[model samples]
Target chain A: MSARTLLRVLPPVVLLALLAYLPYLSFSVPGVLPGRVNGPGSMQLLATCLVFAGFALSYDVVFGRTGLLSFGHALFIAAGSYLLTVSLADWSMPLPLAVLVALGGTTLLALVVGAVALRVGGIAFAMVTLAFAQAASIIVLRDPAGVTGGEEGKALARDAVPELLVGVANAPYRYWLALGFLVVALVLVRLLVRSRAGHAMAAVRENESRAAVLGLSVYRVKLLALVVGSFLGGLGGVVHALVLGGSGPHLTTAEFTLSLLVMVVLGGAGSTWGAVVGGFLYHYADARLTEASGSGVLDALPGVLQSVLAQPLFVLGAFFVVVVYFAPSGLTGLGGRLVRKGVRT
Target chain B: MSDLVLVLVTGLGLGALYFLAASGLSLVYGLMGVLNFAHGSFMTAGAYAAWLTMDALPGSMAVGLRLLVAAVVAVLVGAAVGVLAEAVLIRPLYRHHIQQVLVTVGLSLASVAAVQGIWGSDPHPVAKPALLAGTVEVLGARLPVDRFLYLAVALALYGGLLALLERTRLGLVIRAGVENRTMVQALGIDVRRTFTVVFGLGGAVAALAGVLYSQYAGTVSPLQGGSLLIYAFIVVVIGGMGSLTGTAVAAMAVGLVQQLANYYAASGIGDLSVVLLLALVLLLRPSSLKGAAA
Candidate 1:
């Protein structure tokens, strides 16, 4: 490899190496993590963050790269999560078969929903996807025949799963699984974006009519992006279920999908690394902010102010608005600008 | 037969609430090309405003009088919020449709969370006038009096909106802008002001819907606006974006379908059927819903 290529790749490689070694570390981040880096609590949090990072990156494939503003990305994730548990607990499927069923079912769902939703372009497409997702959410919440466990959500069937993935002592294993999922997702997304289809998606995003005039099948390219993005998102959901031990009704809300949008935008859309960073930071902040809210510092504030700051979502949402106004390109874009400015100075 | 009457009247009432919510959404989307996610926040704010108003009033005050005052406060608050949001959050990012939508999304999340933080997530019982709380027999079916109030208020708003759109100078400009904003701008009209006005109007109507919805449910919660917003969104889409008449028609259909299905079939089936209706509408009559203006 050339010197420039080596320089470009070295930082991420080092970062990944450090992350992989995290479970062995004794370091604790006060106020940031609940325990030492190697402890179960911290490991589980990190694993959840990694899964969300992968999920946000998958969303970016459609939202940033392909310019499809879907409000129903949560549906596929929920499908993966609910399907995995159902297959294991109810259908009596083995671990391997259950995983396959979850992933395969999610992918097939994405294809079918995409094909139908893609028929209408722009905001209509968003609404259609949302409607489909809302339908799925209703079905899940209703828990037809009691398979989904309804509002309480279904727990992972321990007996149907492997032993290594079950207990708190095996958090590192789950963390590793989460890391592996992120790496796989990153590789797949990178591969997809580097392909001919990726270029077509970009063209379609820029101007569908012009792309079509240039002999590109706009519809097919969009469908491909949605399918790929959703498939990866489904993978994230599977990892999320494993790391968290179960999927809740929270996963099925439109708010979850919107949060993914916030993460992608916060990290800077259209860039894989930006999404990962955004997703990781968002999940980390969401988890830690609740802790911070109860800390002594917030107690010093006046009643109304303290109450307002107590909700992590309020802070994140306000920050998102500020970012939208000032940092339209997101944190990554802001960083790039700062770097460019430094060089100029 | 009595059950049918109750369901039908109740459906119309629900449809009225949906219309109140969807009308503003339709107008804003029609003229501004913004899907205001914060519209739900506006509803929540209005509901809380009314709740606070009623709570603050002296206990000696008549319940009916207190509610009337609360309704006015809610409407005014909703209008003010709508205008302020448009001027501050929306006007800055003119022409950037996605960013506009995203900002609204952020606003919705932040405001809703703030409300939740302050009030807690649980539903709070809303006080109602004895008249509104009572039931009226209609066609041998005892129906909640609030349902009729919903219908009356919705019809008044609908008629008021129609007159404003069809009769006034501002209405003409708004209508013209929705049809072709550039053309209206080319004619030396400041369409931006109309955007703000439309937003304020939409907000007021949405707030009114929120108040009425709270009355219907007999409770107010931070999440109340969100659940209702989904149906409102469906109504807007099914009716065709920006067409007030279409929104009203679609709202009633969705309401009736939801009520009838919930009653006839399973409980949650109504919600599912409404979605199925949206899908069918989009699939079968895609062109009809495309770029339709007020």
Candidate 2:
């Protein structure tokens, strides 16, 4: 290949090599967990976030590109998760099969949800999706006596072996797995957003009336957007179930719900990488805040707030207010501004 | 039959609470177009205030004194929130709807944290005044006197608000401002002052609801405001934002529907009935229910 072609493929080629060689260190190092580093709990959390990154990206596509606020994207995740679990339990399906089923199931679910949600544009979509999410969550929470394992959650019976996944069997391995999916998902999203579909979605979001007058099928475009969004959401669930080893109803925690929204807003909502980067920043900050509480330095924050400010939610709450009140463009937007100014100079 | 009646009364009482809680929210939406998610947080704040003051007061105070104390505390706190939020947070986003949404979301987050920090994440209980705590026989059934009291307080507040909106010069300015803010401002009237006044009034009403609900439930959870805000948004959309009568009517209907739903459907599907009703409403009369907001 020419030097130009070589340069284009070099980064991903290098990354592949690095991942292949990472297993060597796990065995060579004395204290490392034989083939990987990092514990299970965190591996699961990080993995879930990585999968959520795809969901967020799809959301950014619709929200930023189409001005369609869909709060029920959570339903897609739930649907995908349930499908994966059932496939594993009933069919003893391999992970790939499970993922395939989940993607198809979620895409179909997305079609249904989008059918109703897209019927009305703007705020109406948001309300409908929100209502759907609430109803779906309640259903999941209620089915505990049998299929769902209820509040307890169900785990996949099949084991994920090291040989099955480049011969590593821990969270660090799972983290790499998750990171791999996230990278691919991110690249795909970036490509899609640069395509004609992306332009059409943007056209509709910016001005539906104009797009309609131009003869673009607004409804069809919206359907495709939501379907893509749902597919990503399900794919995320597949990786989430694989890396985390378990799933449940409470997975729809308020913190996760609120934080996901905050992350999208914080990262400036539109860009693909913004979703991934925002996920990391938000989850990391939240984890750190919870751990750091009562450590005397920040203890004063909660202690002084008449003893009620000690919770990590307070920190999140404060962050929300500051950002909303002051930085409407979000951190990514600010970064974009700085970059623009620097280039101009 | 008795159980049905019980659910009906309970739902109506809770609906009044919801309506009262939503009053400030709708008003804020009307005057400023801000959703005021923090309206629920303000209710928690008022509840906390009432609890704090109750603890501070040693002897048993009269019912009137307690109500006065709670109302005053709510009004003062509400006014502070209104002014500070308007000046520092919301003022910058004036007429910019997107910024208004972002800032309000942030404000809600901040308020939740502030309250949690002050009260601890643990639930705080507010004691009902002894006079209001006991129940009375009404319509051949034993009823929680406080429920009727809330209903009474809500009606009184509504009456007073209607009078204020209709009879006073401030009211005329507000009405004129809501219909056409630019026209009033162009006529040399101070719109900023009007915005501030309406915001303060909205906050006060929300705080009052918070205090009343707290004493009635005898507990304040952090999620109190957050969850309440969700229902209020639905109710407002249903009732038509900025329509006082619409808010009251929608609030009661939702209250009854949800309460009855909770009574019959297993805890799992209890919330479903309301959602189903809302869905039906949306399907049939989407525009009429949500009014102009959607």
Candidate 3:
């Protein structure tokens, strides 16, 4: 890529960089809340958004790049989280070590899943991936007594060290950590997308028959993407568990799974910034809509509406429709269109 | 012997219900080649429609009346969906498989949300006909009257669908359309209209499943569509994609597998185990299924 092309992408990249360091700004400035962020709940929301942004990106790898729509990628995330919890909480391994284990574990699992699920393309790919995910989730749900903690998830005891991390356990500190992870994830993904493997994936997705005629191993590219996608999913899951402090069968639920995918669609698949922005917007509604109050009696409205909108599945579903219908290219596409209009004007 | 009979009967009953839904999904995918993700959402809608009707109608005739109401509503709703979907999404991406798949997925999400916006997400209880609620002892096996009724409905619907496909002019067009859409169009019948009819039939069949699902599950929640929609995809894949016979056999297999697995793995990993089985079956028999189709 030329400097001129990079120049066009710089604005959004720089803007995200600033957002990443927001926690540092808050911490250096004034009184800040511990664990909760901003001395208020704002920081908590930011961290939440960043973590899931990581998740949506993973889905983007498969759905956006590979053009494979998987209804069950949550399997890898839940797998990573449990592995992390067992490592750090029950066994008391170092946090960094646990995260590494999670990465490797999920990567291996993805490899196995991808090997078989990628055997065919089209609807078969979607169905088989979903079957794998649902199967894993059911197994976890059934084991209520053991690893999953059943319907009730198990909690990780915050270790002393990452003692520095523990000391700065405020929202801002957590924000920077998550941001660091996000940058690493993005850079790695960017590098991968530029690799020969990524080109192969694009080729396979374009026209499998032609790609096969050209002697490209279609299944190999898919397997690579699936494994990489799963690795990212597992990493995101670790961050999510670290943020939430516990794990449960909620991992098996469709609500969050669909929401994560919806975020990918909303942000525009195949774009890094799209996933980030989509994640922020999703968390905004998640945190704010449930807590929104207008009038004096609005305070009571949250209590009542909270139960009704307790699940954002409907909203996410609506977003999926709207995004796919109007903005097929997603927010990224919309951005491209806006830029074109501005240039013309 | 009696216990075995009970399990088999109940499994058949459940399997029949699934067939009602999967048949529609398979038909839509076969003709259009777009995997309709929203099939489940319609099922959820049909369940609610049937529930509301049964609840409103007077006793002694509520069951029959609700069935009539649900079947009509299901067909109409399915037709409306077919028309709207064909006009907006389907018509544009006639040959583009990826676009068609993504559009239907979007439609599925939209429909599910629309249903939620209208009805909310709470589970709604659907009452079976009071006349058929009692249990009957047949051949030493105790079975609910509704189960027998479901089996009967399933047989009738399948027979009717088979006959219509084999004997009717519309069926001939659809079959011709599936075999070669361009050729069918060249033959002078509007292939698009043929698609519309197929969509309507698919939707109506889905509705029938929803009616039965509500009564069998005892509660039809807002999640019914998304929930059942996933199963439709699974059933279709296992059923050999575009084959009607494949769809029926696959649904029965899935239903019976659900029962037998529930019996054995009931304590832990039962449900997951079944899904795992689905995954394994595909991985091993990839050729026998999609392989044949390709």
User: Considering every candidate listed, which one attains the maximal TM-score?
Assistant: 1
* Tens-digit lDDT string for candidate 3 (B244-271): 7787887778777777667655644435
Across all models, the iRMS values in order are 1.0, 2.9, 4.1
Best by lDDT: 1
Those runs of model 3 whose alpha carbons end farther than 4 Å from true positions after fitting are: A1-13, A24-37, A90-94, A159-169, A248-250, A293-316, B59-75, B110-118, B265-270, B291-294
lDDT of 2 by residue, B15-120 (tens): 8887888777877777666766567767777667767776677656775586677678777887777777777767777877655765566566666776766666
What DockQ does each prediction reach against the true complex?
0.77, 0.45, 0.36
Listed in order, each prediction's TM-score against the native is 0.98, 0.86, 0.89
Task: Tell me the TM-score of candidate 3's A chain.
Answer: 0.86
Clashing pairs in 1: none
Clashes of 2: 12
Sort by DockQ, top down from the best = 1, 2, 3
TM-score of chain B of 3: 0.90
